[model samples]
Target: MPRPICSQCQFLIQQCLCDHLSVVKSDIELVIMQHPSEVGHAKNSVRLLPHLLDKVRIVVGETEQDFAQLKAELEAESRPIYLLYPSEQSVEASQVKHSQQGILIVLDGTWRKALKLLKFNPWLLSFQSLHFSPQAPSRYRIRKASRIDSLSSLEAAAFGLQALQPQMDIKPILSAFDAMIEQQLVHMPEHVQARY
Candidate 1:
């Protein structure tokens, strides 16, 4: 039989980590373009964004048509929007400055898939890009990522948003990520756990 799931965190009922969550209550707007393959995947990190940023929006699709509405909505907003992606053209997240809060767009998927989203949605390139100089390595050890330095969407959101809004508290987001990893770790075999 399938274990009952928590409607909020989507973890098994017994494994629900919602108790570890605390509301950040920030006005920071976040739009996450999630690859369809990642939508319901258990390892998806962007799922944790709502617990941190109450106003986060997650759109599930990969092509331009999938994001046309989002693109139009973004165009109507006069506030600055920054894409949290790493590239030679991207500046450190801390360098972005504006008089008012801005929106953050993040791609949620593996490195290759994320690049594919970028390719399929060229409009995403118009936004200013920002990257992080992370203080630590990725905490998402349960899943394999293409690059050793790749961070989960939740981690990138927390760090990237922190750079833009220096006063926002990100510990709750990070703690939830750790707790989820620990939950998944308990289910893995000793051999699988050793690889991470």
Candidate 2:
């Protein structure tokens, strides 16, 4: 084996491409919950995704129990809840409009980690699953996925919010994220050259 190379962008950097970030407008409240390992990880994008959006909140897990409480608190806001996980059995977010009284929850992690979250947290499963079909390959260069349709948290947020609020111009936010990624990538090669 070639030391378990990153499947996405194929660069290591702790296998993350999270520096690019954006926030989108949505009438429904959006919450992104990430696993514990992701907090200190250089590639972690979950934290950045929420900051880009107007009403997005992100919470990282220090313990599963705390995250559970947080989820309950978020869900208690008296709105329809949906989780973004693409599955044939799951209800797609595009198929339904949340209107004024809904909350959409997104989880960020590796595929295995996401599956673990779904397995350990039954309350999370209680929400209707929000499935999305993206038109582009994930911009994340660090970790690869089997599907080109998969997108980063920020990218997904843009598409989802665009779907929800067609009037909002989220282009600037997306452009900013793209610039950040390019800047970071440019600096990375120089650092490598210096070491050689």
Candidate 3:
């Protein structure tokens, strides 16, 4: 079945409310592995993070060949890689896996999809996973979560980059993300926005 047009904007779901679109400027590189289903999700902010910072890259799709190619490029660089996740098997965000350049791999999708991406891409498991304890609520209203400290893709990049480079002021980026989410929520119907 064709997806319903967004009631408020009359645009296709992919173009309606794009919360995922963000700008990023950071010293650390961010590689987002996004799920196909999350491409249009209003709460997915991976696309937007690169605008806020300068050091961001995004790759969509989940395939062994793609992961292998990414791994080859990353391995050639003299940097440490980290998988940004909140699991018992993860690493702390406070410490850098390597003193050289750091490549942060983030899975931008639902929890289940994220797990699938991680599991399917065994090369990602070789990197130390970075997990954090957030002091704020998530701004992603369209997506439901089992955790209160959940954050949007942009938020994760902002915080992760900040942790890596303490000299940068990442608050403004996060604020912009929040403002964007608020604007999107205001345009959405009360019932849909209420879920946030």
| Candidate that would win on lDDT | 1
Candidates in order have lDDT scores of: 0.87, 0.65, 0.72
* TM-score, per-candidate, Cα-based: 0.94, 0.75, 0.80
The TM-score of predicted model 3 comes to 0.80
Better model by lDDT, 2 or 3? 3
On TM-score, the stronger of 1 and 2 is 1
Q: Once model 1 is optimally superposed onto the true structure by TM-score, how far is the C-alpha of residue 195 displaced, in angstroms?
A: 2.6
- Which lDDT tens digits does candidate 3 get at residues 1-196? 9867756434456455444334445667888888778887755666556556677778888777767777789778777778898888886687664556678888988778888888878877777888877767776666678767777777786787777777778766876666666666777888987677
Error of 2 at 63 (Å): 5.8
Ranked by TM-score, top first: 1, 3, 2
Give the count of colliding residue pairs in each prediction: 0, 8, 21
Which parts of model 1 have CA positions greater than 4 angstroms off?
none
Whole-model lDDT, candidate 1?
0.87
Displacement of the residue 11 alpha carbon in candidate 1, Å: 1.6
Model 2 scores a TM of 0.75
